[model samples]
Target: MTSSRLDGTSALVTGGGSGIGLACARRLAADGADVMICGRTAERLQAAAKELGCRYVVADVVDEDQVAAAVRATAATSPLRAVIHCAGGTTSVGPIPQLDTAAWRDTLELNATGTMLVLKHSARLMARTGGGAFVAISSIASSNTHRWFGAYGVSKAAVDHLVQLGADELGGAGIRVNGIRPGLVRTELVAGITDPGPVLDDYLACMPLDRVGEPEDIAEAARFLAGPESSWITGQVVNVDGGHHLRRGPDFRAVFEPMFGAEALGGVIPEE
Candidate 1:
């Protein structure tokens, strides 16, 4: 029975050019918030912003200065009432023993560090103006365990923890922080991984609802968290994964075994 409106406020969505980010941006705008989309690609951002009738800033969420700038820019037009952080992915997938160090760092920087910067900067504006809702997009990998998911899972786990910490710390400032853990969502960004034969099939076998999720599915959850309906909710990470959490995490051996030979991915404790 809540109005669930957000007139006169501004929102920032990282990775807003496409996929879940774009869906979230569209939904937030529909709820009456002025929206600004940010990402590293100018072409995609420009196209999405134009189509959505919103603003776009080409900024990498991993860059502190860029994140701060995006937050400031969003606030320039409105009080920056909401921020949906959807900018995350990882190149650090492989067996732990053979995981590339550089890729691991990159993953942490993109997912964990990026979330830190967004929360840090956006909270400042929201605190000064009044308060706002911040939603971090995490992955099912954070909660569900699987092989060859070390780096990405660890980074997302950091994000989940950060959401809780941010909610606890920033509550005094009237800001609320929450997180969403999406399951195998069908997005172009992950086409290479899931569109292929076995990955998608393998995922379905593990989902209780037994189907990949649409971008809009995640968007619906995000809209509730970002809007007034969930005003009292904070520090929670909701799973919009079609009950996938009830089952075991998807096994990517079919997808990853070839890339990382089964022999190498063979989990063995490295000598101390």
Candidate 2:
């Protein structure tokens, strides 16, 4: 059982339908916060909320109106004390030069812009309610130059800076903003892309902890940042990758090369 550090407070988690978002919601709820989760899918949101004993809101982070409405609805139910921005994903993966412009735009729009919008609206409510904490789900790829993770890494890098800027601007309002850069967590998003066997092995070999991260691992970091434990910590991106960041990331190009062929990878894949 988790401690009730957040009793009588409320938390809003974007992308809470599944994966890291759902984990964060459950952790906050367990800590005695009235949690509300928002996502684009109604069915997933309903199921997640039911399981977490929280509320659900169908809202896409990319949609400004929907995000504002979600915040307003959550605030009406309880004092908004925490906001976890976890709704982001890469639309495509490849080298920057060959990457489609549409994919690049979409990635930034979802990962970076989405975090900004959530932080913007959530901060406003937090300021009115005596302030709170804001946590954004970032990626260790933001710092490393991982092959085939160009757009995703770039977008997360943008999120890292946004968290810093938000922390600086909202400090006067008593609002603390931070980010969690998870390494390789086995979530549905990861499962949809490729088999985890080889990737997990690669990560475990380099990771000091000798294992891949779980959703609950990142959830614990989110819990710390959202709760009073991290009151003095702000504007920082915490790495929760089980020491994977100390070394390089998995070479995704090596995994996809045979399927896509060397010619298809263009300059993205280096000569062996």
Candidate 3:
């Protein structure tokens, strides 16, 4: 179905420089919202902004001062109607013993703390006008387990709760808060893996839909959460995982066994 539901509305998307964020920004713009894309990288943000015909802001969500500034800047230019928290990254991967403290902390700050900042500032502004929508991009990892994904998963679990807290508090004020938890998606980050081919094949095998996710899949969900169609849907965590959550994940053991030799079978506790 087609929608001009967001006509005259304005949206600010963090991490909108590429990937799912960019897809959501463009979709919002097409649906009639005046969109704003923000990211730490100026060049990438500008390119994305230009493509979507939306404004761009350079702000690292992990930096509170930068986040506040970005919020103020967005407020100065438009009547903000929605905020999509998509700025995040997993800088490291390993079991706790092998994990770097700094990387773990950064992951928490970027995914959980950053989302809190965006929600806090945006809710304050949107509430002043008596309402808006806030949609966070969480991950299936929040409810799933994986090797070397502990820090990232924990942070996202925090985000899921945080989003609900925002929703519970703001729903009375007419501001709705929700989030989308996506499974394995095809993006630059996923492509960065050394040998994603076999791993992805295994992932696809477990999905009921038998396919990997795309940025647009998540983007469409974001648009729905942002628009009036979901007016009564607050404090919800929608999974756009192409049915991956319904089945067991790939056999990481078989995928990584050869690479790690006997160690993959000997010492490590196999993940589900």
Candidate 4:
């Protein structure tokens, strides 16, 4: 399990400053891949690169030029065989009737369009080297319904479909595109929602395993898909959730109601 399955190759890990992104970068580097981590924060990426002993790039995935530059930098020394896009989050949350248009667009730009630009530029470099693997860190919300998570769900759903199309289009170039839908993972991003409370309890109740996931859980899957072990797999969005998808997404009403007003969300979120 610790063998150098990706020796002599290179990997580009986005949002590598922390959480699942950093975990994947560590796993990939430990496996002997020349790794380059990128993110919007210079201070964090600097710290991560120093600790991980991998190169770092300060680039925004939503920016095409920045994304393209990151790819070029990663492949400059070795073939960029693996691109793990773990950079994405949503600021937009509310009922469809009250969804902020600007927030919605921004969420789509960051999650959905950002994914396209990353894949577009990374594929250009990967195709030149005869092909590579692209792993997208998606969410179960993309497939399952999570009421009050308007823009985020829509955007991630787009990402899932985009992966399918990318896999279909890039198969000829020897590239494989896949996605990972993670369940409720313990990370700083979701810290507020998971602070020992009713919201956290609801999430645990929905999960068949009745526990949260770790960054390494998703990282292990990324390592496999990026290597030859999943050589025949492509165009598939694998769920790494703790059986949460089998039931339903957590009720965010307990959390979102306090912000957007219970009456508003109640008007929309169906009661089961």
RMSD from true fold, candidate 1:
1.7
Candidate 4 positional error at 173, Å? 0.8
Residue 55 in candidate 4 has what lDDT? Answer: 97
Candidate 4 stretches greater than 4 Å from native: 1-4, 268-272
On lDDT, the stronger of 2 and 4 is: 4
Minimal lDDT window, size 10, model 4: 263-272
Question: Per-residue lDDT for 1-272 in model 2, tens only?
Answer: 44548989889999999999999999999888999999999999999988988999999999999999999998887899999999999876765555678989999999999999999999999998899999999999898767777589999999999999999999999999999999888788787333646666776776898766789999999999999888889999999988888998776656667756676566644454
Cα error, candidate 3, residue 122 (Å): 0.4
Give the per-residue lDDT of model 3 (tens digit) for 40-142: 8999987887777888889988788888878777767567888888998887565444567898899998899999999988888888876889999999888
TM-scores of the models, in the order given: 0.96, 0.93, 0.91, 0.96
Query: Who is ahead in TM-score, 1 or 2?
Result: 1
Model 4, position 41, has a per-residue lDDT of 98
Question: TM-score of the candidate numbered 1?
Answer: 0.96
1-272: candidate 1 lDDT, tens digit per residue? 87878888999999999999999999999989999999999999999999999999999988899999999999998799899999998888787787789999999999999999999999988999999999999988899986787689899999999999999999999899999999988899778767757777878888879878999999999999988899899999999998988878887888777887777667754565
Deviation (Å) of 224 in candidate 2 = 0.7
Q: Flag regions of model 1 displaced more than 4 Å.
A: 268-272
- Overall local distance difference test of candidate 3: 0.83
Better candidate by lDDT, 2 or 3: 2
TM-score of 4: 0.96
Clashes of 2: 0
Ranking by lDDT: 4, 1, 2, 3
RMSD of each: 1.7, 3.0, 3.4, 2.9
